[model samples]
Target: MDSNDVRRQWEARSGEYSPEYYAYYGPNDTSDALRCIFEQFLEPNASVLELGCSSGRHLSHLSVHGFENLAGIEVNPDAFDVMAETYPDLAAEGEFYLDAIEDVVTDFDDGEFDAVYSVETLQHLHPDAEWVFDELARITSDLLVTVENEGDVDRDGSTEPDVNYVNDDFPLYYRDWNTIFTDRGLVEVDAREGQRDTIRTFRTAQ
Candidate 1:
């Protein structure tokens, strides 16, 4: 699917998503493993950009922890609206662009952010869309991180029964990090496997 199709799919399910969607990663409510890992790499004032930052939950967490320069890009207008309305302070402090990751790179300069991270976001892109990786790397200076389920499960339509919300007509594209990023000149620095997904960190090869 193209960018417009991806937008339509997400826009259709935006209203169904809620703050509770991030219950698994919430700072005080659940496991601090993810937060602890982020703290190790993200400096206090790091300029961080979150691709596909739905409802800004991670951005809010970073804000609470004193990461001053936070920004995000979301394709769904409904989700962006909810984030802007729910976290006005963070919305004001940072930039939240309503645009697709594939097209947002033209809006920023090279190495504009200290780090660019996405949690369970890249997997949603079409399997052949490797341009997304190059664009993200272009804007990131120091680090790139992705948290996703890596496997051969390719299914399209509503999400599985485990999710609290309904993400309809969405295509799942699980990518091989070793081939995608490494082939593009990024070296994997750290990788932590979880029960459901894997979190991988990368930097431009020296």
Candidate 2:
């Protein structure tokens, strides 16, 4: 599907995989892991941005852990409503952009954020907008991380088609997070594999 079509579909999603739906899940292991990474590598005031922060669930974890500067890009407008209702503290404190990541991220200046991260978000980026990968690298001054279900069909996910459709709808693009960012001028500093996600952290090479 076209990138615009993909954005529209995600923007309209509700009931399941929607803002409220994901908000219901709250903070899980992924959330804990992300918090640990931040606490260890960054100061509490480090500027952080989440690529697709549905209802601000993960960001809420960071907020509660004492990270003050936070922002998020989410396509679903209802996400802000749900976030305002659920994570009121985050909603009040966080700078949120209610638009697709592709659109909002471009306006950011180079090295605008101290740290940038995404949770299962980049995989959904349509190939047409894959250039946003470079933009992601460009905007983060200190650190960049990706926690994603990087592959489904195999260990390296090398054999699967470039684009995998989920439940006959939406697109998930398989990518090597380490290779992608490293090629974009970041250095892969840490990597770990979970049952569902591959977490990779990169630093702007000194």
Candidate 3:
């Protein structure tokens, strides 16, 4: 699928993911792990940004944990609407972008955010838009975390894109995230494989 098709797919699934389920039960296991990592490495005032943050469920978890300087980039506008309803404090306090990440991420100044993270998000980025990985590296000043579907991410796997359309209806491009960011000038700090995703944390070498 092309970038536009990927964006449209999320837009269509917006209400389905966050508005209903996440709204009721709130954050999940990954969300809790994300918060703990942030707490271990950052202060409450750190400028944090989440890419493809659907309905602020994860960001809301950060907000409740005392991390106030929050932001999100979401392609689905309805997700923002649900964010406003489900996580009102987050909706009011956090900055947000309602557009495809490839289009808006470049607008951020170099090292604009103290920490940047994504959960099951970057894996969906279409191959044509993979350049945004470098953009993400450019914008993050301190830490970057990627919680994505695990796949080939070894010595040879880092050399190229390892893509898989996990579902007929959506694109799930597994990538060697460690090599991708490390080559972009970040150093891997920690990596762990979860039940459903691989979580890797990177920090700017500089």
Candidate 4:
């Protein structure tokens, strides 16, 4: 399937994933790993850009912990509306766009954000991961936190993802975090493995 097809699938799935059961508790032990990274890498009251904020799960968590300047990018307008309405004090209304990743212009001036984050999103990127990493590098000034499922897959034949949120067509690379980010000038600061996921925290070189 093409990008448009994948997006439609995501939108169709979005309605079924409610914040109550799925967003906070459905993904297994990944939440523990993500919270650990959040506590370790994120600064108090820091400006944050969440690439795939999905129902404002992490944003809500961060806000309760005193990080107020939070922003997010979600392609599903209905989900974005729910998030915006849910967290009016923290979420910037209409900031979330229903556009594709490549089309949405981050447009932030240089060093405009303290950190950029994505969770379970990269594995589904279309046309490979080039555009995803490019945008991560473009927006982040200091830190980038990512969490993806690490599992072997049949890449050459069936384009089905090992993880639910991943896009099967792109062949998700589930290797060591150090190996993945080394060439991009991002140093892996910390890494941990959960029940079926790996969370990597990287910092840009000064």
Which prediction has the highest TM-score against the true structure?
2
lDDT of 3 by residue, 25-135 (tens): 779899999999999999999999999888888899999999989999988777778788888889998999988898899899999999999998898888888889989
Better of 1 and 3 by lDDT: 3
**Of the candidates shown, which would achieve the greatest lDDT relative to the real structure?**
2
Ten-residue stretch with the least lDDT total in model 1: 157-166
lDDT of 1: 0.70
Which lDDT tens digits does candidate 4 get at residues 94-202? 2455655656635666656778777766656654434456567767788887777757554454334343333333334444445556667788888777566677788
Determine which window of 10 residues in candidate 2 has minimal summed lDDT: 152-161
Winner on TM-score between 1 and 4 is 1
Write down the TM-score of every candidate.
0.80, 0.95, 0.92, 0.76
Ranking by lDDT: 2, 3, 1, 4
Q: Compared with the true structure, what per-residue lDDT tens digits does model 2 show for residues 4-88?
A: 9999999999887899998999998999999999888999999999999999999999999999999999999999999999999
Kindly report which residue pairs in candidate 4 clash with one another. Answer: 124-167
Off by over 4 Å in 1: 1-3, 15-34, 152-168
Error of 3 at 109 (Å): 0.5
- The TM-score between candidate 2 and the true structure equals 0.95
Per-residue CA lDDT of model 1 for 35-136, tens digit only, reads: 565588778788888888877877887787777888888876666566667777787888888877777766789889888887777877764455677777
